[model samples]
Target: MDHTNKLFVIKLTHTLIWMFFVAVIFYVVYSGITGAINTYTWLGIVLVIGEGIVLLLFRMFCPLTVLARKYSDSQKDNFDIFLPNWLAKNNKLIFTTIFLIGLVLVIIRTLF
Candidate 1:
């Protein structure tokens, strides 16, 4: 591949990594807003905002995206394969954990 293609691959990989993080953030907000807004209460609104902040913090401190970027950069020649697998396997795990946490929060909110 040419130099331009290599740089494109790198940039594309970075964009994908950022996108995963964005999706996670969106999921958190979606879960929070959907759950809490349905109740139509002040506490629920507060919780929604709280969850959004938590999600932002989680994204900020997350190591998985950093690792993914590193993995992507290392495989510019074969990045198409590497980036997807990294995002699919590792990113899925991380997002699943967040979803589970969201589930737990939903349950808690429902119960009390």
Candidate 2:
């Protein structure tokens, strides 16, 4: 495909992946808050942790973002994804805080 098409595909894929992770994160939080920990909760936790490792391996950049960089010169934060610019800019901070809170709740629920 052409560069434009390729970039669009990347952006779409990235947005879908972001949505999946958002669901997983919220599920984890919900499970923790409701004290309904189960196999799915553990699976979601593992997936989120794996995502964190991948980000670390990529030096805190999503691999898709790096790949998308080759296609566009736009400096906007949401250039690689369908998120709002402000949300894209602070995506990591926002999600990581939410994830941490959920994790803490999970730990507390599990231990208590």
Candidate 3:
């Protein structure tokens, strides 16, 4: 009900969402590596792309992060989410690379 509670809720939600996407990304990678492409693979791809669009709309920041910013003035990278500072700092770069690799593998498997 207060700002602290609100920020905690936001951070928790953001962390859960991040975990979901991480699972999706790993599923995509697994699908590609195993040549098990299916409807779920496509769904994961679509979800990741949609997430990318959302990030772009927010100028590369998660909407939750933007919202969380209003509640806290911490300069730490992980302030908006329940991630380690280093992980939060490199989250985009790390996950994007993994997603792209999986995408490329998916394309190759699909074409061949």
Following a full C-alpha superposition, what root-mean-square deviation does model 2 have from the true structure? Answer: 0.6
lDDT head-to-head 1 vs 3, winner: 3
Candidate that scores best on lDDT: 3
Off by over 4 Å in 3: none
Best by TM-score: 3
Q: Write the per-residue lDDT of candidate 2 for residues 1-112, one digit (tens) a residue.
A: 9999999999999999999999999998998899999999999999999999999999999999999999999999999999999999999999999988898899899999
Tens digits of lDDT, candidate 1, 32-104: 5466524434344455455557547778433434444543455332343334555644654565466556656
Q: Higher TM-score: candidate 2 or 3?
A: 3
Q: Candidate 1's C-alpha lDDT?
A: 0.52
Top-down lDDT ranking:
3, 2, 1
Candidate 3 lDDT over residue span 7-94, tens digit each:
9999999999999999999999998899999999999999999999999999999999999999999999999999999999999999
The TM-score obtained by model 3 is 0.98
Model 2 misplaced regions, further than 4 Å: none
Q: Name every residue pair that clashes in candidate 3.
A: none
How close to the true structure is residue 4 of candidate 1, measured as C-alpha lDDT?
51
